[model samples]
Target: MLLADGIHAVITDRHGGISAEPYTSRNLGGAVGDDFDAVLRNRHDTAVELGVDPARVVMMRQVHGRDVRFVTEPFGDDPPPLDAIYTTEPGLALNVLVADCAPVLLADPVARVVGAAHSGRPGTQLGVVPALVEAMATRGAEPYQMVALIGPAACGLCYEVPAEMREDVARVVPEAWATTRQGTPAVDIRAAIEAQLHKANITDIRHDARCTIETPDLFSYRRDSRTGRFGGFIWLDGG
Candidate 1:
């Protein structure tokens, strides 16, 4: 899906890479017990498909909080610790790793900028999207001109949260209760993120119906205890 004008990006599944066993085929995380070479290869292929230089795609260690970083240029070496990333520069891709957590791609076509965020329970509880929005605005993005794509994530139907976790979600937005669709209480992370988007005045929104946990093609941390991660990346077009 498209987030901003002149921007192209996609979220990948776990079925097309070279990793083996628990990582299976397309694991993109180097720190999750997968062979580093396998994760590197998957990352390289993913970048090629998106027309980005593997080196320009910036990623973070992902501390699962509300931290967001606005990158004016690609990282020189190791990435910083952050949950969300935004960049206005063309050819610089922003990547966020996830298994069951939500990956959000944000864009302001008019500004020619894009952002990607890792939103699991912890990041959601910490308000990562809102932080991303504010960070993008500082780089000159306006909410009305932004389009947000909530990609494949753990669906509420398959994501049964503990009662305490549900209560934490409720504390953020009481309306989150409406997303509960089954016997076991689930959190519609997309809905919760969308609510945050609306609050920020970002109206363009799209939600992919794929559930990473229920679907075998993608990776899921909760579904498979030793699973690898799939990545979501975006960048402004060059040439």
Candidate 2:
């Protein structure tokens, strides 16, 4: 969906590229064992489709922790280890790669600040989503004034986990606690993240609603051990 003038944000599905096999056509993840050149070409082509320069894309190593960083410039291919990337500077887009994890895109049109985040069960339990909101707040983005887009992820019904792990995450985010389709304990990472954003007063949120594990059009690391990752991007226009 179009966020606003000068703000470009979108979530890519696992299609429309040149990778083969498990990666299929569209694979934005570089470290997922896809051919380096194919991955690079797919990334560049995706950026070109978005009218952005491939070199200017800002991404993270994404350690599934609470580390959030601000971007004033590009960091090339070797991005730092962090879960969230925010930018007030125009022309620099933030990209978040995900397989079963939630990819969050933030935009505050009034403040001209945008951010992208990758959050899984660990990140949800560790308050990474709130940290990204706080980072945006420091840059003049009020929580209520911003809109967040939660990309596709493994749903609660499909994301079964250990009983202890579910209990651990549920302690912090009760909204995430759930039972899988087969009556197994599970954690809905996206639901937990949305709850966090709501607690921070960020109520304007959208969701892609596609489950990675259930959708063949999207890649799922849990479903395919060698799967490639799709991505979501957020940016402001320099012009």
Candidate 3:
């Protein structure tokens, strides 16, 4: 998807690649129990399909914190534990892997800045998406001029949580408070993220409404404990 004049974003699903059963095919996450080589292959293939160099794709360790980094190159074999990364360099695609967590892509074409963030329950509470916006602002990207794409994740109706847990998250993010379809407590991570983006003054927001837990084509840790992770990739068109 073209996010702006020269910025592009892509969200991957479970179909297409070679990771085997549990982590079957197109699993871009290396930390998962999938074969190392298979995960590497999947990453390479996904980058190629996106017209980006595999060597240039920057993947995060994603500790589900609010740590944001301004990266000029890939993190190599040992990526730091971070939830968000922004870059001013063109063609260096920032990758965020997730099963049920929200993968957020942000870009300001005029500033030539792009960022990707991993926002799960903890990350949302920590305000990772807002942190990413701040990191990108350091490179001249303004919140009002930026566009955001939120990828597939567990929806409120399917993301049931303990009553105490929901109340705790809602204390920090009221928009996260929700009730599941079965009338149980739930936390709407995506809705909370959207609210966060709006609070940051990013009005141009798009979303892939597919719920990971309800969508079979996408990996969902809540639905299947042992599952592969898909990726949300964002990059500039030229180097």
Candidate 4:
């Protein structure tokens, strides 16, 4: 899965690598209890596949809140506690690991600035997408010219939530409020995110309609809590 021009944006699935069961195959999440070595290997392989430098690839410890970071260089060892990361510098790959939460890739090719965000239910309610656009604005990127790409996540029909929770989220992201196949309350994170993008004046938006929970090819925390996480990456071509 790839998108945008000039900027390299790739969505990684659970298909290759050496993480054992539960966190089977291409699991890039190191903290999910997957073999640390395997996670490192997967991350390295993912970077190589994208033509990005493994040493410069940065992954955030997503807290599911609206925190954005401007990366000029890689974080030596510790991953930052953030949900979104933007960078104008090339060679550094911004990665967001997700099992069900929507992974968003944003880029302003003209400005050569790109961003990656993890927008979960809580993050969506907190308006993480808007926060990301604002962060990009600081780097001379505008919403109108940005291209937004949303990756696989849990769909409304499969993301049944408590009525009260749905109401709370709806208050913030009304576009997400939906009904499940069983007549239960649910939230379409993807729809809510797309609505947010439109609200930000971003017209060039693409979505990977494959639902992680429903699609066996992707990792799904809802379907398998102990499962591994797939990764979404965005990088500028320094060359």
Best lDDT goes to which candidate?
A: 3
lDDT of each: 0.84, 0.90, 0.94, 0.90
Residue range 1-239, candidate 1, lDDT tens digits: 45556888788888888999989998989889999988889989888877788878888888889988888776655777889999888889888899888999999988887999999877877899999999999888999999888888887777788777888887996545434466877677767888999999999888776988888988898899898998888888883
Q: Tens-digit lDDT track for model 3 on 126-239?
A: 999999999899899999999999999999999999999999999999999999999999999999999999999999999999999999999999999998999999999888
Best by TM-score: 3
Q: In model 1, what is the error at residue 59, expressed in angstroms?
A: 0.7
Residue-by-residue lDDT tens digits, candidate 2, 61-157: 9899999998887777688889998989888879999999999898899999999889998988998889999999999998888999989999999
Lowest-sum lDDT 10-residue window in model 4: 1-10
TM-score of 3: 0.99
lDDT of 1: 0.84
Model 4: runs farther than 4 Å from truth?
A: none
Candidate 4 lDDT, tens digit per residue, 27-97? 98877888898888988987888788888988888898999999888777787789999999877889899
- What's the number of clashes in each of the models? 2, 0, 0, 0
So what's the TM-score on candidate 4? 0.97
| True-structure lDDT of candidate 4 | 0.90
